[model samples]
Target: MAELESPRVMSKLISFLSSLLQRVAESNDLNRRLQPQKISVFHGLTRPTISIENYLDRILKYANCSPSCFIVSYIYLDRFTQRQPALPINSFNVHRLLITSVMVAAKFMDDMYYNNAYYAKVGGISTAEMNFLEVDFLFGLGFHLNVTPTTFHTYCSYLQREMLMQPPTINSAESSLCMGKSSKLHLCFNDDESSHQQQQQQQLAV
Candidate 1:
């Protein structure tokens, strides 16, 4: 794995990821107003007061995982959404989703990481809930946790395009969070798929 990113780069990465997730959650929330979706264990009875940016920043500040873990976590999220189409990410569930995905990513990709109890405290949930979330998320994703080098590069390129399209501005009034036009994330992880096909899917509707 690559060395950890510098603080500045990591901060920028966090800001970019936070903005992207916030946009996804907000979009899903708007959609849910029209058609209610099935709620799962990931959903909270009420949305947490903490802003998405602050919550993600807190995770990065304390988790101490490699930068690659962030990318991997996002991959896990996309996979989960694909497998569980009824559970599109929304404001009520995104926070728990973020914490669980990051924790699982750290466990898979990092040599050393804090246990579930510590992550539970950081995420403002009980240790038992955190453990349950980890298991449910893995099953939701069918335990397909290994990210090949090609798949990793594909996601990195997609994020690079996103950063270029929308510069890393956290919450500027002038900034708009218009994501890519497609409604589906075209991340083809099948080994049989060609790189060119995956590159085309890099538009990344999410």
Candidate 2:
């Protein structure tokens, strides 16, 4: 847990989230430009009006969950999207999904996490809505809450590599080169699935 709170870990988490927000922004911009006719029919039409950075800042300041919980929340987000193909992460639902994932991760990973009501208040949502979202997200994830050490490290490494590959600014001429380097990092995880599964099985047997 202490390791989770370390500066390195926190930086990696922030970088990972920043990348996701960047993607969301790009996707929204592309939709606005290339699909103007279909924009009104987009699922993100009902998405929250809040900025992703501001929303994440609110959670960082008020959620009071372990820093590790944020990392776990990222993992849950990945698993949730994989399991529920219908609910892809995007601007329309990402904010709500972030709050639900972090709340659920905190509850599962922290022994002293706040209750659903408190989480609702922190997330600026009704308690009942929070409860409903929690239930829905749990089912969406199929209750696979356990993350092995190997998997955790793999994610951390991936985020760190991405951070290193991100150009300092959007207009940098080297941005494309940096993105190419980042794409290569996916190979690091290509062989991780079998090892991660084996680690999970060993832990379960213990």
Give the candidate number with the greatest TM-score.
1
Q: Give the Cα error of residue 3 in candidate 1, in Å.
A: 8.5
lDDT of 2 by residue, 1-206 (tens): 34566767675556567566556445544454443322211134465777766777788877777787787787787776556544445566677778898888777666566677777777777878888888888888787777777777767665566666762233211111122235521112222333222111111110
Model 2 worst lDDT window (10 residues): 197-206
Per-model TM-score versus the true fold: 0.81, 0.70
**Candidate 1 lDDT by residue in tens digits, 1-206:** 23227777667677888887787777677777666588888999999999998999999887777788898898888788778777878899999999999988888777667788888888999989998999999999998888778778877777776666764332321112222343243454554323221111111111
The lDDT of each candidate is 0.75, 0.61
* Candidate 1 wrongly placed segments (more than 4 Å): 1-4, 167-206
**Candidate 1 weakest lDDT stretch, 10 residues:** 197-206
Model 2 pairs in collision: none
Query: Clashes per prediction?
Result: 0, 0
- C-alpha lDDT of residue 95 in model 2: 76
